[model samples]
Target chain A: MAYVKINKDRCKGCGLCIQNCKLALLVIVEDELNVLGYHPVGFVDGEGECKGCKFCAETCPDCAIEVYK
Target chain B: MTTEAKDKPKKVYGRPESLKDVGFHFCPGCNHGNVHKMVAEAIDEFGVREKTIGVAGVGCGVFLYNYIDIDVLEAPHGRACAEATGVSRVHPDHVVFTYQGDGDLAAIGIAETIHAANRGEHITVLFVNNTVYGMTGGQMAPTTLLGQKTTTSPYGREFMGEGYPIKMAEMLATLEGTAFVARVACNTPKNIMAAKRAIKKAFKMQIDKMGFTFVEILSACPTNWGMDAVTANKRVEEEMIPYFPLGILKERTTADYL
Candidate 1:
């Protein structure tokens, strides 16, 4: 059972987490331009390859990201 | 879908979910950021973000609610302890902590801090002592040592003109109600690790329903110190350490705990 989990609803677009990720694993998914408006960033790919560093999860201005090793 | 990507959010350890989406108002090299990060880390490690109430001081960190994700209560320039007393009483089960600077805690609020620690209030105080008043321009503070120059004491602080710096941790250790009293600096990676340990223990003491626990962190204020960020860090090692020797002043473990 991993302890980290990212709450997608609360994710903000700040990339501080991306800066801190040493393993080069996190990429931001910008708003895809839905019918209503722009949306917050989401994990682009490599969800399973997370080293569980929690760097992005920790530095995220929003508690939108989670991690469990 | 590849780990080879250049941009990746590292697995940030010790991140908690209770913090909301807000940055901080501290300076670029201020130690408040480190303290805030450590508090959040401890909250995450202990799983107490939901039940932790952070009381912010009225110094440079007056707007600390911006960074920390928990429920932060802002206190007047020197009234964090008084406010924490009320908050802790209201929410006994919650972990209450206060983040304050030397001027806010050791100077203007010294009386409040002493009384609160003396009263054995079940709260943790994260005290950052940069040895000078950081906000409202640098000035001679109660923790400013002899010979150290400040805006108010450009010719070096005269013992006759300015009283000696207050050894807050030593003073508070005599109160008897204080459960943990440790001093750690943030001058290097080793000190950073030590600071983390002190922070973790302070949080744990509060969890065990212990009395007052105070961690004095020797921090740097490059802007106020009239030096660059790097110099400020080295000053903590060369100058500050000689005066305020770092170590666990008082610990209550088992035999000591009893």
Candidate 2:
């Protein structure tokens, strides 16, 4: 199993990570707003489902995602 | 205690050391942030942060100094190349580079860029070509494609009125003094990786005392393009790449200089 941490305040809610994740394990929390007043992305299954591919981290333009294996 | 300890995963990927901890001012999904990371990664890999000097031009990329943890100088609009030329000449041992936008490099600063490259100044130029003048509210730029609309050209760019989009990398490649020139994009993972390599190579070229090196990154301007970040990235892959083909337009050898 792998884990991903997102710097919520730094996220812009662009969803690039969501689109890039091949596992479809990421989602944007539309109900919650970050300090920047935008919805930030989160993992659907937390650490359980992530495969540590780092596709989300690689595609995050804001450098908001940190993945660990 | 054992359960808690087992839950933590080792840190694998994070921000580069050469970049500062401050949040970027660029809009969400903007390519500047990614490019900045690539530049910082190159600096970190080469272990040249202390001896690196960055020259920033006026535009969205003007705040590059705020993100990059290195000595940086702010140059007047379209004068980054000129300023970098001076800095590289004065501090020959230090690595000097300029960060510029399409309008700053290809339009107003074209003369400085051409002359600097023509003179074979040992410096690196990171040029971002987003097709429009993003900082000043999406005005048409020299790289703006025909039929692409902008605030200044709301009715779509016309060939007769606006002329053709400038092919900067191709044009610079023909110059005798340029040692390396390549055009890359930041739209996809593969392309972004390629861009990082090109950026690193450009810096390496400067460290090797090769002539002027240039890397033009085709970036996305979602706000200006009136699209979401994903769509803007798609546009770069679909529209921009076709117009500005990717690859090394030129690479000079010792024989050419001799």
Task: Compare the candidates by DockQ and give the number of the best one.
Answer: 2
- Each model: TM-score of chain B? 0.91, 0.96
Error of 1 at B14 (Å): 8.2
Give the alpha carbon lDDT tens digit for every residue of B132-247 in model 2. 99999999999999999999999999999989999999999999889999999988888888999999999998998989999999999999999999999999989999999999
Binned by DockQ into CAPRI classes (incorrect, acceptable, medium, high), candidate 1 is: incorrect
Model 1: DockQ vs. true structure: 0.09
The ten-residue window of minimal lDDT in model 1 chain B covers B6-15
Estimate, for each residue in B1-258, the C-alpha lDDT of model 1 and write its tens digit.
676553554443544454445544555345666666667778888998789998999787776677767789989888999999999999999999999998899888999999999888889998989988898798988999789888999998987978888899999988878989999987665676788899999989888877899999998887888875556767888989889889889887632345
What value does the lDDT take at residue B87 in candidate 2? 96
* lDDT by residue for model 2 (A1-69), tens: 688889999999998888888888888998999999999897787448788877788778888889888
RMSD of candidate 1 to the true fold?
7.7
Cα miss at B168, model 1 (Å)? 0.4
TM-scores of the candidates in the order shown: 0.75, 0.96
Expressed as tens digits, the lDDT of each residue in A1-69 for candidate 1 is 223455554443334455556656555556443222324445544456655655565444334566755
Q: What value of lDDT does candidate 1 attain over all alpha carbons?
A: 0.75
- Report the Cα RMSD per candidate: 7.7, 2.1
Best by TM-score: 2
